[model samples]
Structures are given as C-alpha cells and as structure tokens.
Target: MKIAIIGAGNMGGSIARGLAKGSLIDDSDIIVSNPSAGKLEKLKKEFPGISVTNNNAEAATGADIVILAVKPWFIEPVMRELKLKSKQILISVAAGISFEELAHYVVAPEMAMFRLIPNTAISELESMTLVAARNTNDEQDKFILRLFSEMGTVMLIPEDKIAAATALASCGIAYVLKYVQA
Candidate 1:
C-alpha cells in the first residue's frame, strides 16, 4: 500500500525511518512531503528507496493512507489544502485536535479517520501509540493496529478517552524520563 506522510519534521521523519526498517511495507511505497527541502533531503539520504517531495498534494494523490505529522496549528490548513478523498485513510499525529474538529476540516466528515498519539519513543520504534478511529470497519482498524504495532505498542481506544490516553501515554513518557534522571 502507498503511504504519504505530510511533513518531514521529527515525527514524520521518524515514522518514515521506522517503517523503512520494518517489513510491513516497502520503502519505495512511502512518500514524504515537506515545504523545506533540507529535511526531505536528509530522509532521502537515510532511506534512498523512499520518495520525497515538496508538494503535499502530489505526495497524497494516489496514497492509500495519508499521515498528517505537521504541528497542531497547521492541521486545518494542511487538511484544507490536501482535499483528501473519502476513500483514503487519514491519520493525524498532531495533539489537541479532536475528531470533531478534524471532521470539519475534511471533505468527508464520515471518512475513515484516526487520531494517533505517539510519544517521542517512536523514534526508536518503541513508542506507546494511542489510536482512536472514526467511521472505520474492523478490517481497517486491524490493519492500522498491525501497521503501527511495528513501531511500538498500540492501544485502540474510544474517541472520548483520547485526551486521557494522550496524557498517560504521550506526556507520561516525559515523566518517566525525569524520574529516570532523578
């Protein structure tokens, strides 16, 4: 399956690298897009098989899954610009954007969408990734769970509990780090 990552920043770059190291999908099937060329160039150097682009729309065009790894503030604008198809799966890694807000941003509010909260440990392929789905079937849910499970432990949770899960799995990692340092 073709996967498009919009934003070659830390999270996006890390996900690309992790996927490249995994067996779920081929590196050649992954496409990463970012406005700045430097990060894209760095990712290309690290994973030559993966494709890179400066155009978000181009990256997302034929992709089966589109991951939004941009900052929370950019989510709305980026979603607007992509004009994603209802058939494509949307996964947002940006924190603080709820399903309700995301629904307003997309062309099809009932499209299969997911909110993923992965901690910094995803860089090492050992994150606690919280996933919440909307308008998705069992098969789609299982596919996403298995896809992300390659990078880390995955928990399928209710949309209402996303904030709490985010705090425990995402912010809690920092707390653990501080305790370890102490």
Candidate 2:
C-alpha cells in the first residue's frame, strides 16, 4: 500500500525511517512531506527511496494511507490541504483530536480515520501505542493494526480513553523527559 507521512519531523520521520529500515514497507512506496526544506532534504538523503515534498496535498494525493503527523496546533491548517480519498485511512498521531471531530473534513463515506498515541520510545521499538478506529470495518481495522504493529505493539482502545492515552504516550513523552532531566 502507498503511504504518505504529512509531517516529516521527529515522530513522522522516525516512523518512515523505521518502516523502511525494517522492510515493513518499501522505501519506494513511502512518501514524506514537511514544511521545512531542510528536513525534507535531510529525509531525502536519509531515505533515498522515499519521495520527500513540501506540498501536503501532493504528499497525500494518491496515498492509500496518510499519516497526519503535524503538531496539534497545526492539524487544522494541514488537514485543509489534505484530501483523503474514501479508500485512504487518515491516521493522526496528534494529541487530543478525537475521531468524531476529525471526520468533519473526511469526504469519503468509507473514510477510516484514527487517533493514535505512540510514545517517543517507538524509536527504540518499545512503545505501547494506543489506536482507535472511527468508521472503519474489521478488514480495514486489521490492516491498520498490522501497519502500526511494525512500529511496536498496538492496542485498540475505546475513543474515550484516547485522551488519557495521548497524555500518557504523546504529551507524556515530554513529561517523561522532564523527569529524566530532573
């Protein structure tokens, strides 16, 4: 499946890099885009098989799965440019954006949107990633779970628990760092 990562920062880039390195997806099948030319350029050099771009819409154009990896504050702006096809699954690692709210922009009746909470430990392949499905079928849900499984163990949780999961895994990454610093 063709995959697009909309934000090629620490988390997104790390996921792409890990996927390619692990042979979970062919580097040629993966696409990455970021606002920063420097990061995109770096990504190009780091993963030569993946196409890196600055256009969010272009990055997501033909993607079967699009990862909305932008920061929480930037989700609205980024989501504006992304047009998720009905077959496309929009997975956001962004904290706090719920599935119901995310479906507002989804034009596809079969649009499969999800919220995930993955800790920084994913870089080390040790993350308790929380996943939630919205308007997704069993087949699609299993497919998504399989994809995330490449990064680490995945758990399908209730939509209500996504927030705490986000707090514990997403924002909590920084919180844990603070303790390490202390």
Candidate 3:
C-alpha cells in the first residue's frame, strides 16, 4: 500500500522514517511532499527510496493512505486542491482541528478520516498515540489505526474527546520531559 505524507518537517519526517525503517512500510510505497523544498530534500537524502513532490495533490494521488502533516492553518486550502478517492483514508495530525471540521473540508465526504494524537516519544518508538475513527467504516478505521500502530501503541477513543486527549497525550509529553529534566 502506498502512503503519502503532506509535510516533511520534524514530526512528518519521524513518521515517515518510522514507517519505512521500522518495517511497517516499504520504501517504494511511501511518498512525501512539502511546500519547503529544503525539507523535502532533507528527507530525500535520508530516505532516497521514496518519492518527493512540491505538489500536495501529486504526492497524494492514488495513494492508499494520506497523512495531513502540514500546519493547521494550511490544511483547508491544501486539501481543497487535492482530490481524494473514495477508497482513500486520511490520517490527520493537525493540532486544534477536529474530525468533523476536517470531514467538511475534504473533497470526498465519504473519504474516511482518522484522528491521531501522538507525542514526541514517537521519535524513539515510545509513544502513546490515540486514534479516533470519524464517520468511517470498520475497514477504514482499522486501516488508519494500523498505520499509527507502527509508530507506537494505539488507544481508540471517541472523536468528541480527541481534543482533550490531545492535551493529555500531546502536551503531557512535555510535562513528563520536564519532570525528567528535574
């Protein structure tokens, strides 16, 4: 299955590496795109097997899975330009964006959405990632959960509680790190 990542920054880079190097996905099956060519080049140097693009729609085209790895403010316009197939599953990692809102923005309402909140520990493969299915079927939800499971443990939660879960799971990581530093 092909996977496309919309941004290749720190978090996006980590997730791409985890999928390719962690044996969850093959290099040939992964594609990434970013508005910043520098970041795309950086990822290319590290993982030469995958493809990179400046066009978000081109990167996402025909992929079985698409990751919305860009910043929150850029999501709507970017997704508007991209066309998602009915079979395509979107995994949104944008902070402060809710699933219902995301569903309204995508080209395909029938396109499945999975909400995930993963902490920084994912870089070390020690993350507690929360997964929530949004107006999706069992097959699509499982498909989304399976992808995040590659980076860390999965906790299924309701979409309404995902923002709260993000606070506890995402922000809480920094607090834990502060405790460690003390």
| TM-score per candidate, chains pooled | 0.95, 0.90, 0.91
Which residue pairs in model 3 clash with each other? none
Tens-digit per-residue lDDT, 3-56, candidate 3: 998988877777777777667678989999888799878878988998999899
lDDT of 1 by residue, 32-89 (tens): 9999999999999988999999999999999999999999999988988999999999
lDDT measured at residue 31 in model 3 versus the true structure, 0 to 100: 95
Q: TM-score: which candidate is best? A: 1
Minimal lDDT window, size 10, model 3: 118-127
Task: Report the C-alpha lDDT of model 2 over 55-135, residue by residue, as the tens digit.
Answer: 989989999889988888888778876867887888998877777667766677458888877765565566678899888
Relative to the unseen true structure, what is the C-alpha lDDT of residue 48 in candidate 3, on a scale of 0 to 100? 94
Worst 10 residues of 1 by lDDT: 118-127
Model 2 lDDT, full chain set: 0.81
